[model samples]
Target: MINAKEAFLKASTELKENGIENSTYEVREIFKELLKLNPFDIDFAQKELSQSQEDLLNDAVNRRKMHEPLQYILKKWEFMSLDFNVRSGVLIPRQDTETLVECALEVVKQNNFTQCADLCTGSGCIGISLCHYSKGLFTQGYDISDAAIELATENAFLNSCDRFIAKKHDVLLSAIGKYDIIVSNPPYIKTQVISSLQSEVKDYEPHLALDGGESGYEFYKAIIPLWKNALNKGGYMCFECGEGQAEEIVKLFEVNGFSQIRTFKDYNKIDRVISAKLL
Candidate 1:
């Protein structure tokens, strides 16, 4: 007999008490999904909750209480103006990664690169967004994890980026072709730092996508040389980096023959992107 508003408030309060961040928004979204009601529609409805709906809401609340990621509970996430299916095995696309996409697009626009590669294409967010934003640019995305490749492929189709191809190939071991532009938001969080991350990330997200080796620059080290070999002269490479990691990544690129290196900051003024062109 509880009204929708009452249920939402109760759920929100419970979630907050359990240390879940964004409790109100999480509860509201759960209510919306269960009742097929929007936030505004919650108050107008007088219908009783169905048994299945009640069960779903309760399960979701419990999961949130455990500090599970909201995206995992919902089984989907949004990035770059598109919806993507996500599960525990795949790293959820984050807003900060969009900065990598924007920077890559700018490089492509400035240099008119017709082909690009998205290394470590988790969920296909970068490559798919590139194809969506860059007209006539052919994009190829590579991931070492099979699950990541499957999910990225699904995301590509979901975003209507059929021209974008997602492949399973380890950047560290594979021989890749030269590209005009290459962008990656690779795993940059140091291995030792993984356990200290929020539960939503360390517990729920895939470790394969979060651990960047002991120094958190394993992928950067492995890819820089490969990128140097794979990018045409004058082609560009961009990486989404963790704070304090941009300079080290830039040095890697520079030592491997990249030039005109530069880093771009996110809205918070933290350096989040590094860009350079092949010599």
Candidate 2:
């Protein structure tokens, strides 16, 4: 048995020694997730974790030391203030992608768009969030990975998004259905640069969801024109872009006859999201 405070400090030290940033925060989360203890509460010191709980905490920390993503270890993450189920085979939802969702929501509300197509949907975070927030919106999400489809289906149910549908599909092949809004946060990392990414990403995250081909714009290139006709006239297409890649994506939208292209920056002021409308 171990007291909550002791377990927290031990985990924090181990993670810090392993060069993990935000070690304290991660420890707090681990305690909450595994042991169901809130380290910040006044009674936290009075709580003791059973031996089994301690073992679970230790195992989680050990996984972190191996450079596994904390989100994957926890099997859950938050995007757009909504909880999402995530695991090894599925790409974890990210805060950066929230910018894309926010832009899509605005388009949905402004035009009262009822249907949304989420291409390359990983955890279905983008589509699920849209359906969660919009009463009339129905979203169809497609991904190449069966794991993603399964998890996304579970997540939509978990989040009470009855209108959200997850389907197994390769977005590179062809467009499927018509929609008033289409959004994607597809693979945008350059193939050569992916090897140099942090171990938590390069070693643990799925490469099928990371490799964006040589120019890091392969998905955007294929998605823009392929899905253009699938988008209703005056409908919107939103994308989460990599750093310095937004400009090129905007050009692709223009060449595909999209108009009113707009770019939004993430918290870091990086060009992170681009939204364009079918002409």
Candidate 3:
């Protein structure tokens, strides 16, 4: 019944009233997703939404008003410029994580690495993107959450990266097999700090993917030592760290006797990714 422009204004107003920053962008994304209308382009002005389409848009807006992440509501998000499926149980892919992917790709290219193990591979973003970008690269993605595993596998197939395999495995355990490189964007939020994160993260995102234990280094502490055994001699380990966590993570790699340690920053210049090579 309502024209697309009116729907866009109404949704944007409602979302802005709910304190959602980037309300306009969110509204445009919702409109494009639910109504198949490009709110930014010329065609969006002449478009109209059917009754069911309007209902769907309203439902999406209501969900966003509750502080649910827009990515989860859309059930898909872009990472490394590739589409990935996401939902309630899996942690949504984020731009910061792309730094880890880039560093891993660099390592893979420089070292001619082909076998990779991706830990906490939510939505298969990092591993799949590696395989997507680097030909002949094969990745085995591991996660503890069944939902994460399912979505990761689905994302692998969606990206046409059949070389990426998703499996349910706790990273705290011993390594399964040796690989040319190991990469991860493991959960590193301090447990107490998690509760203080924005509602979109604390309420909607899975704690299993956010709670990094009391020190926020639980996964890193475990994976660095345990999974390093799974890496071939001279293999590499690349990881995405929390804002202030990379320095200490580098120390961990040092203590583990990893050589050629290096850190990379995200667009925000935060120390986001760290890499090291086994001697």
Candidate 4:
């Protein structure tokens, strides 16, 4: 008997009580996803939700109340204004990482680079975005998780980035082929501090994409040396880092024979991306 707007308002209140920051946005998204209709389309004020749709709404609200991510619930997200498929077990693309992509684009354009290796590519956001922003750029993305690889591949196809390829490989174990650029947003959250993060991250997001080992630099330490062989002379390397970790990652790039090391902050002004060039 409840109307659509009434149901949404109730769900939003519940979400607010649960401390979800994007409660209002989540409600609109859920309506679009579950009901095949946008809440704001055609003035939902007078439209009553069907019984089945109401049940679906309740389920979505409860899931969010339990700290599940809205992206996972919607099964889609946007990166750099491009749509990407999202699901559990694969890392969701964060807007902060867009700073890394933007910075890398400058290097790619400066060198007229046409090929890139995206290590630890989750959902192929970085690699796919590069190919999108620059025509003729080919991209290869690698990840250890089968789910991540599969999702990344699907995203490449979804975005019509035919030159993008995703493979299953751990950056810590081996290196990709030489490319004009290499980018990664590897797990950088410290092993110990992961548990203290927000429930949306600690409880819902994949730990394999967040844990950075004892010093929050295990992947960086392991991949820098290994990736050295895959980077061509004068090629660029870039990374998305946790707050305050860019300095250490720049030092790692320096240790591995990279120069012109620089860092870029996200909109939040947190040190988020670091870049360097191979000497």
Give the best candidate by lDDT.
2
Ten contiguous residues minimizing lDDT sum, candidate 2: 29-38
Each model's lDDT comes to 0.85, 0.92, 0.92, 0.90
| Runs in model 3 lying further than 4 Å from the true structure | none
lDDT of 1 by residue, 1-279 (tens): 556666667789999999987898888778765556566763445656666766787899999999998888887877888888887888898898888898998898888888899898988888998889988899999989999899988888888887699999888886488799989888889999999998889888889888899999998998888667888888889999999998888889878888899999986889999999888
**Is 1 or 2 the stronger prediction by lDDT?**
2
Using TM-score, rank the candidates from best to worst: 2, 3, 4, 1
Q: Which candidate do you rate higher for TM-score, 3 or 4?
A: 3
Task: Give lDDT tens digits, candidate 2, residues 1-279.
Answer: 788888889899999999999999998888888777888899988888899889889999999999899999888998898989889988889888989988999999999999999998989999999998888999999999999999999999999889999999888898989999999999999999998999999998899999899999999999899998899889999999899999999999999999999999998999999999989
TM-score of 3: 0.98
CA lDDT, candidate 3, residue 138: 94
| Range of the 10 consecutive residues with the lowest summed lDDT in candidate 3 | 31-40
lDDT of 4 by residue, 110-173 (tens): 8899879999998899999999999978999999999999999899889988989999987898
How far residue 144's Cα lies from its native spot in candidate 1, in Å, is: 1.1
TM-score of each: 0.95, 0.98, 0.98, 0.97
Error of 1 at 11 (Å): 0.9
RMSD per model, one decimal = 1.5, 0.8, 0.9, 1.2
